[model samples]
Target chain A: LAKTTQPISMDSYEGQEVNITCSHNNIATNDYITWYQQFPSQGPRFIIQGYKTKVTNEVASLFIPADRKSSTLSLPRVSLSDTAVYYCLVQGSARQLTFGSGTQLTVLP
Target chain B: EPEVTQTPSHQVTQMGQEVILRCVPISNHLYFYWYRQILGQKVEFLVSFYNNEISEKSEIFDDQFSVERPDGSNFTLKIRSTKLEDSAMYFCASSERADTDTQYFGPGTRLTVL
Candidate 1:
């Protein structure tokens, strides 16, 4: 399994864009990057996933450069409801998954 | 919008007692996993079961912990001897496959050991 690093917390205001980046220096070729969001007391919800390049969905966008060492999760025009802990993970074929501390986004109004 | 379901949203048990946490995964999912999170901590993986056997597990899952798929519809985690440190929210998750598939989580069972 590949290890991942992310910031402990981030602060953003409503209507502003927020970007949280995760580093996985030992990422393997078969690893796929996936992002999940968790609100207080709720299960982590799937946000977006990407192998490389840029992938955009109705909720958020994931950007991975050619190196794939790191990836960025972009949330445009964030709202108060977007305040939550975002987890970046490398889903591997074997082993139980691992989750990091995650970047807690505080979207202050 | 099918989701994983777990029983006893919250459980309170005395130390050294036996406790069972149950889960019913999505109907189509082939892989099942158990994870736990202490309040204000990162989620930790415990075990993963597929095809009626454990495909993978973490160090956290010791002899004290066991998993079973008693019947076709239910999966369960059994703790033979609960310790004070076992107080944490246990989450049940399932994926369509054991490899390269996203796992969906349940609301979690908050276990409080005294």
Candidate 2:
């Protein structure tokens, strides 16, 4: 398991793009970067995952640099409902996934 | 989307009492996991099950904790003795595979141990 560091909190307004970056300096070769979003009183939900380069889905985009030491989760045109805690996890096979304190994203109206 | 479902949205129990939390994972998923979040804390992994056996478990999963897949559709977690520290939101999740598949999580069972 690779330890991850992200901001403690972020503030965004409606219709603006929000990008949250995670730093995993000790990332291993087999580790993959995965992002999850959790609202209060709910389970975490998978947002995006990537091994390298960039991957995009209906909800968000993940950008992994060439070094793979860090990754960014980008959410476009955010809304108030997007307010949640975002977690960045790095792990390989046969390892228990760990979640850090995560970045608390507050989407203001 | 097929999602995991957990029973007893909220459970209140006394100290030293045994409690069982049940979950119904996605129909096609093969890997199951249990995680808990102490209020205002990070989510912690408890255990992962695959092929009718435990693949991984955290230190938090002590002797008091056990997991079982009684039948094809249901997965369960048992706490032999509850403590006040056991109060937290227990989440059940499942993935199609363990390597890179995305895990879908249930709403969670909020256990309050007094």
For residues B1-114, write the lDDT of model 2, one tens digit per residue. Answer: 788999989999999999999999999999999999999998999999999999999999999999999999999999999999999999999998886678889999999998
- Report how far off residue B109 is in candidate 1 (Å): 0.4
Model 1 alpha-carbon miss at residue A40, Å: 2.2
Worst 10 residues of 2 chain A by lDDT: A89-98
Q: What TM-score against the true fold does each predicted structure earn?
A: 0.96, 0.98
Model 1 lDDT, residue A45, Cα: 83
Model 1: residues with Cα > 4 Å off, grouped in runs: none
* Over 4 Å off, model 2: none
Measure candidate 1: CA RMSD: 1.1
DockQ score of each predicted structure, in the order shown:
0.77, 0.71
Q: Can you write out model 1's per-residue Cα lDDT over A38-66, one digit (the tens) per residue?
A: 99877788898899999999999999999
Whole-structure CA lDDT of model 1: 0.93
